[model samples]
Target: MALEKFMKIKETLLGVDIGYDSVKIVALRKGNGFHQLRSSNIIAIPPKSLQQKSADLDKIAEAINTARKTARPRISEKLAVSGLPESKVFTKIIQVPQMTDEELKTAVPNEAARHIPLSLDEIYLDWQKLGENSKNSFDVLVVAAPKFLVENYLVLFKKVNLELIAIETKGIAASRSIIKKGEENTIIILDIGAEATGISIFDLGSIKFSYTIPHGGNTLTKSIAAALKMTNEEAEKLK
Candidate 1:
């Protein structure tokens, strides 16, 4: 999941966030010691476009392309990064006997099967060594995503001609982007999206837990519309 380590430093990086309600794109230029936002855009998706059993990849891809074009007329760097929804990704922190990197490579896969509910064949696995504990055990952060879900992302990015350099969990991306330094005390982050809400517990400079609720802003809007006998659009504006 942390594919950024393998990427060559680029002048600009494109961020693509494909949500249930909208496709968002942002271009950032790396500066001397900071990043400058070049341009950004958001395009709404058709209602229930992503909630169906089989999503319409074509329409989703089209929305992403439109957002990219509107975000920046011509982004020089095609390298991009995207996030998998918190609900679709599985993450766990496990303790293992301290071992060399080579040994952990083989050990992690065997260990992951116990922590992750899905079969090994159904997921793409990745891991990072956190640090050693007092008991001489290493804490490793394991991440996995369903193969089909990841393939859809690849296909969508292919259709839009952006090189997907990395795919991170939404919680990781949010913490990295917004959490300030020296604020390492345990804190909860609530990401309220249109169709879902992501709750993440961040502490010691990493995410300890992440959960998603199916209800979000759209659900509230629907409730308001029903109670007031107003249109969804009107309720949305009022909200």
Candidate 2:
């Protein structure tokens, strides 16, 4: 998702992260120089509730509402920002010939089709010009997500009475939170979640590359359970 100018200065913002295992909500008050945490809450989802062909949207909506109320934010307008999981997005860094902004707009979609497996009509495409990579070429970060996936999120948030102002990839959010400004060295970030792991490489404060692996905590728990001859619950607790 691209950034939107929906928030005002010093307004309280809600961060909603819906994952495979749980729904998490964080409220933050924006200050002059920093953000203050107001409240945070997490509620677990029923197992396999989100794995079905047709997910239990009512159940998921209930969890989101419960988590939001439990956090107790002072948001009267219910404005929020959500993140798309890395596993559900396609991102790549590509080099393009130096061109003006008007020309780059036409070039990015053509380049996106070459890199992304899906047709251009099926996905929402966004790109940013990183900088000049060479005398004749420049680096462009291309991000794409399926249209249906985004529409589903919009509907889900509507069910919870929240207006999703902006949506971003989790990898970008993690890098912004964890990386220091003006960092000179390259670093890799590993975000391990219940069902997936996000691997992001950052160089000089920008994300250079990112990837997602299907196996995560759940996979580890299963492996541990098999190796130790314990129940999955026991393995989870031990882990």
Candidate 3:
């Protein structure tokens, strides 16, 4: 029955985060009833290839394929979770009356409609119930991303032959790595990427607020290039 039990066990999950200038992949396995990291890899993208409306899809797919091969020994045919770029997603924490999940299910959409600027049909929505407050109200985290943007990511994963199980916002995924279960103290997690910076506040292991700024490492590089009268490439190398 040992072999049977092993066969019944579920496959582990691979987490993927694709940034403007790099792609990161991580695999986790269950050990002693807790999740432990198995392997991780990061692949860099070519310069000037991730511009808006002009991203090099083929290059990204190849990088993902390479990352998969790099971690082949630790990852099998497991499902993967990916995160959309923080610049493209919207996240907010809102208050609602404490109620059952069934009631929240019906109430969330209406509440989201007020917060999200786009039409509901244009975006994919997801939410999580945080906890009850002093007033016996619930704090819910809402996430919305354009449907077309999500579909493009799905297409990219399909091209690489990767099975994507879920897509989350970058801030949420980063919070998972920085916060521990049942942690009481509040803290801020900052992710400075090549093209954007994402800031998130975690309280009691749940994200209470998140914000994304367009300025990042690239901006600093450009400033250095201007100050020294050097090309971007030279400034980047100096940085």
State TM-scores per candidate. Answer: 0.87, 0.91, 0.81
Model 1 Cα RMSD, 1 decimal:
2.7
Q: lDDT per residue, candidate 3, 54-133, as tens digits?
A: 56678888988888788756455556778888777889888888888999988998899998889999889989887876
Order the candidates by lDDT, highest first — what do you get? Answer: 2, 1, 3
- Evaluated against the true structure, the overall lDDT of model 1 is 0.82
Candidate 2, residues 23-104: lDDT per residue as tens digits? 8888877777566787888999976444344667789889987776666553343778888878888989999999999999
Candidate 2: stretches off by over 4 Å: 1-8, 46-53, 72-77
Residue runs of model 1 more than 4 Å from their true location after superposition: 1-8, 47-54, 72-76
lDDT of candidate 3 vs native? 0.79
Error of 2 at 50 (Å): 6.4
In lDDT terms, which candidate is top?
A: 2
lDDT (C-alpha) at residue 83 in model 3? 80
Residue pairs of candidate 1 with colliding backbone atoms: none
Q: Each candidate's lDDT (Cα)?
A: 0.82, 0.83, 0.79
Write one digit per residue (lDDT tens) for candidate 1, span 1-239.
34544433567888888887788888888787566788888998876564444778899988877776666555545889988887777888888898899999889999999988899999999888888765789788889988888888888789878899888888888887778876868988898878788899887887777778988999999999999999999999999
After superposition, which runs of candidate 3 have C-alpha atoms over 4 Å from their true positions?
1-12, 27-40, 44-59, 70-78, 134-136
